[model samples]
Target chain A: MGKTYALTGNPNSGKTTIFNELTGATQYVGNWSGVTVEKKEGTIKNSDIQVVDLPGIYSMSSNSLDEVIALNYITKDKPDGIINVVSASNLQRNLYLTLQLLEMKVPVTLILNMMDEVKRRKINIDHLKLAQILSLRIIPTGADDRKELKNIKDTLTLDEVSNFNRFSYFSEDVQKAINELAQKLRETEHRLENDIHWLALKILEHDREIIERIKIINLGAVELGYKLRDEIQKQTKMELPEILAKQRYDYLREISEQVIEDLDKSLVTETVTDKIDKVLTHRILAIPLFLTIMLMVYYVTITGLGDKTIAFMEWLVGDVITKTVIAGLNTVGASEMVVSLVVDGIIGGVGAVVVFVPQIMILFFFIAILEDSGYMARIAFVMDKIFKKFGLSGKSVIPMLVGSGCSVPGIMATRTLENERDRKLTIILTPFISCGAKLPVYLLFAAAFFPSNSHIIVFSLYLLGILVAILSGVILSKLRYRGEDSDFILELPPYRIPRLKNVAIRMWDKAKDFLSKAGTVIFAASVILWFAQSFDFSFSRVVEPSDSMLASFGKLIAPVFSPLGFGDWITSVAFITGFAAKEIVISTLSVLHGVSEGALVTSLQNIYSPLSAYSFMAFILLASPCFAAISVMKRELNSWRETGFAVLYQTSVAYLISMLIYQVGSLII
Target chain B: MTIVDLKPGQSGQILELNLSTKIKNKLLELGLTPGASVMFVRTAPLGDPINIKVRGFNLGIRREIAQGITLK
Candidate 1:
């Protein structure tokens, strides 16, 4: 059997960069068995040594989702070895995770990354001495060097029978308690296959996951465990976690004193990071700088270059593909029904959603740069104060920003939020942001009704989307998700130049995901929509769509929207087709009205006044996201019931707000 | 004094964490132990969640979490 090695490290330790380099084209990404934490695993290039890239974690304490995923994979899967990545610049704190990996009895090869930064800061680390002290192979590597990359691959294949006997960092009293409990645990069904001492320490530290697991597997062990825990805390005058962490740091401090020069002195005395942060995260300049950056991002993605790319994609998919396919079908003597199905149902429906790819890509491109350069963390740092007021964390800003371009990737980005409630809340709130597709709907209505102040009306609709999201966040935090601690403790990683390759790779992944969804959910929706619009009650193809089954269905649902004032069958059909894609709302109306997009404004002018038009725009802004977004919601929420709840919440909120806008305006105006 | 009690640029040694066991375990793991010195870097723009330097790294810790950590 090929040897399996688990790649583990502290977050922001360049673990991902190392994994990408080592695996190259051999890696594939998938969701972990139960959770949304992404699992990346692959064979080392040119070798059969399998590497499972466990989620980046500070410590294997199972205190966080990442920690639990790493701990479970290591303990249950029982990988042969661990490739623990530690940044050299922050050696002591990074080594904290390294020590935890050692205690698991897995032989760990330490990759001391960012050696150049250490050298630049004039902080000297005796890698040879450090390796000897810990009894692990340490490869100190700089970012620019490829020499150590090969060194890492070579060490992974080696049989590491490491004697990490220095792993015993606990005091005598704590060690005695652990030894007693570990011995007792061996006899119970709580017999961990390996590292029972580590398990003992965890239970003593009040690791709820392990302790709860022990309670079911070995009930009698709980009594002894609690008794020992109480004794240790009383004897040591320290909580178990405190004791464990303190002892580990003490040992790390000791090792650093001997192996690292001037370990007590601050290694970073106003480094480049601090210098940049002074302006970027300054007391007065920070928020303004952040706002300017966000504006630039929005301008580039939504209104500027991003808009041109999107228009190009629309032209490519709409006119080019549609015309080419029609000519091909005509030459083949295909029937009119087949031509309509392929052109209108297939190209028009799926193409409508696919056209947003450029905007999504451009948005993700900037997002990737922010993430890769580490500025994204500072964004959360700057925005946390305001976002916390609404029961959301600062990290929620990224999803909303991404949601403005498209909600699919926006919902996916919620995976970064570690708290379950925060992730769910962000997912529920994100679709309320006016995505680019919804913008066309707003502009069309705005132009048709309030021709002069269309820009302001469109802008108000955008603000309304944000206002509704914030209000919903407040409501949900109180009622749906209360008592769950929305804790925010984010590490501010040192900024680095964003790698173009990494940014491109991120865009590629998002693009691939979007295209796949367009092919599946949106593809199916269009075919069904075509059947609805094409056939009559007896399944006879009709010349006019108003005479077909869709009109009857739209007429039935039209009155349900009467309170919002756009209850006509034409508006109803547009919204129905909009379930597939929002941009299709304009096309559906244009098709049903027998006019092109330019004349669509004059056509809808009589149907809606300024107030009802604004109300109609309000409904589309906050209503249920398109079918493609719903599929993404299903995947991200990982449950149909929660996705259903999210859809219901969005649509109901949309209905109430639209009704309020229309009713209150009619009364006041 | 808790971490929130410290002004910007003020430094203190961690006395104890009064948070729940789970949160305390997390803070401890992040190197806010009894003896570790913490430097309150600055508060965020809207003045609630503060940035602090601990163990040679910066953490954007929520004000609520900071209020639970006793500093000396």
Candidate 2:
């Protein structure tokens, strides 16, 4: 028979790493707790056992979202067994969760991750003694070491998971109180899946979730439980929860005294972590250093190294692939119409967005390094101060940065944030940052209107995006999402040489997502645009694109954007098509005007001056995101109502800002 | 005095937490208890969240949280 087990651990304890190593399921393991905000399941490799990996939690308490989610899964789902992953160096705190798990009567096997790090620190742990003291089986293992990983796999058997022993850690009077409470609860004609002792303890601690549960089953139990806790609280100088915590720690300290041998720290004066933090997180130097780094990342990932590769891709696909396809089709005696559909609709349209894949992948590569190397969290810490002034937190920074690459993954990255309101606000504002696909639109306008200052014009557009995002964040917080994620906390994991395998896997995953999107969405959009411009209504060929079906449709919506200064049917059509995918906007323009890609620049110059052109660029920067990003936003946000609000709000903001820029600039000039 | 009274590199035992139940519970869950020694490691660049070292590991928490935590 197949068995099912769950993996639970504190954040940054390498729980997901063990899950990947053991199950061969490559889930994205971020440096912090956000990526795996939801539970994921995969079958253990070469075994019948199924392993469910839940989000990391510091405790089973339901105050925070992660805790509530993880706690609910364990209580409601009741997996047959649990593998408790703990950072060996931080065993005291990690084990606190283990004790909670044990009280719930789930069979647990402790996997001591980061054992290698402990060894490097020269600290020694007697695992056998610790295991015996806690009445839980402990397996000392490291995430990277083959031998240690093997030890974990060897213990994944049915018998091993069910091998833990039961022990009590509460003080005498507290234990007596818990016993009486459990006895009283058992007397009630109600059934509960959890061990009665755990329920009694949680109730005594006034866990709101469990108290609500008690109110349903036996309302009297709530009063009784609180009465017992009040007596316990009155006797202790410490608070009610701390009374329990003290007892647990007292027992834990005794266990650690026997199990952990202190190492001579004088041998290694100050850790490299300290030396690095002194500089990287320095009070005065941090923000300047961070700005310099962000500029470097922008230059290297988007323009310097990234642009060279993008240029190569554009050349290879546009010149070489088009030439080869035309030659092959000509030999096969393909019709001119068919050839036009194949070359212009398919290759020209999709290839525009496809060339951006390299740039997106480069951004992902850099983000992966920062994430895997542990700098992402530090950046959050450094930026949290400034961000809070805007009613957001530092955690919103990653999603915004990732938004520049692509908004789909950018919305997905908001899972790293723990607060509901903050996540929603970030999702609403992330798409405003100019993505790689929108780069084509900006480049086109800048080149046509302001050739000499195109670079500066584009740079200022990027800044405007950031400015608007922050301002919108402030307004949203003050109006709708009120408080910050005041439980603003993050564990500063020791920095290591980021494992290359993890970074590569993350990059490959992002690349595949980008490529798949480019293949399907852009391909379909291109064919539709081509057909719209090539044929008139009733499916007849039109010599002039102005007489085609798309032109009529563009004329209808053209007036809506008239106030923004670029209101012609052609511009309207381009705007409408750009919604399908931003990169296709330029391609749509080239097709509508019946000009070569190179000559489309001068043709666009004939349409609009620099003033209106800048307004159009501003609109594109803040408008509703593409369909792919919209779907991701829906998934990440709480409700359809929120998603609709986000979409409508973005488009409205875009329209107002564009109109403001155009009207103001027209008056000034 | 509150934890903010401690300078960087200063270590003290936690005395009390004058905070909301949720935030205080979270702090206790993260293993900060009365009498547990914690070092005020350093302030971040923007000087909002203060980093602390406890149980041989580091954590960054908001300064408002730090101000509510009494230590000696």
Interface RMSD of each: 1.5, 3.1
lDDT of 1 at A230: 89
lDDT by residue (tens digit), candidate 1, A1-669: 789899998878888888877787787887776665557888887888899999788888766656788888888778888998899888888999988877777789988898888888888989999999888898878778758777566787775857877447778888888788888788863455666777787778777778877787666666788998888778777777788898898888788888888875754366688778888888899989988997788667756785587678768876788789999999999998998888777776677667777777787898888878889888888888778889998989878877887787788778668778888899999999998778767756776787787667877887899999999999999999897867687899888887676677778877877787678766776677778888989999988988889889889999998999888888988887788777677657755564545566888987888888888899889999998789888877879999999999999999999999999999999
Q: Candidate 1: TM-score?
A: 0.91
Q: Model 2 off-target regions past 4 Å? A: A1-3, A25-43, A159-167, A184-191, A208-223, A234-239, A263-269, A331-334, A415-421, A447-454, A482-487, A584-587, A590-603
Model 2 per-residue lDDT tens digits across residues B28-58: 8877788777788888876779989876678
Shift in Å, residue B16, candidate 1: 1.8
- Across A27-78, the per-residue lDDT of candidate 2 in tens digits comes to 4332213323435566776666777887788888877656776777778777
The prediction achieving the highest lDDT against the true structure is 1
Off by over 4 Å in 1: A1-3, A159-161, A188-191, A405-424, A436-458, A478-486, A573-613, A626-645, A665-669, B4-7
Candidate 2: deviation at residue A428, Å? 2.7
For model 1 chain A, give the 10-residue run with minimal summed lDDT: A590-599
> Model 1's lDDT to the true fold?
0.81
Q: Which ten residues in a row have the lowest lDDT in candidate 1 chain B?
A: B20-29
Tens digit of lDDT per residue, candidate 1, span B10-59? 78888888887767777788888888888888888778678888878888
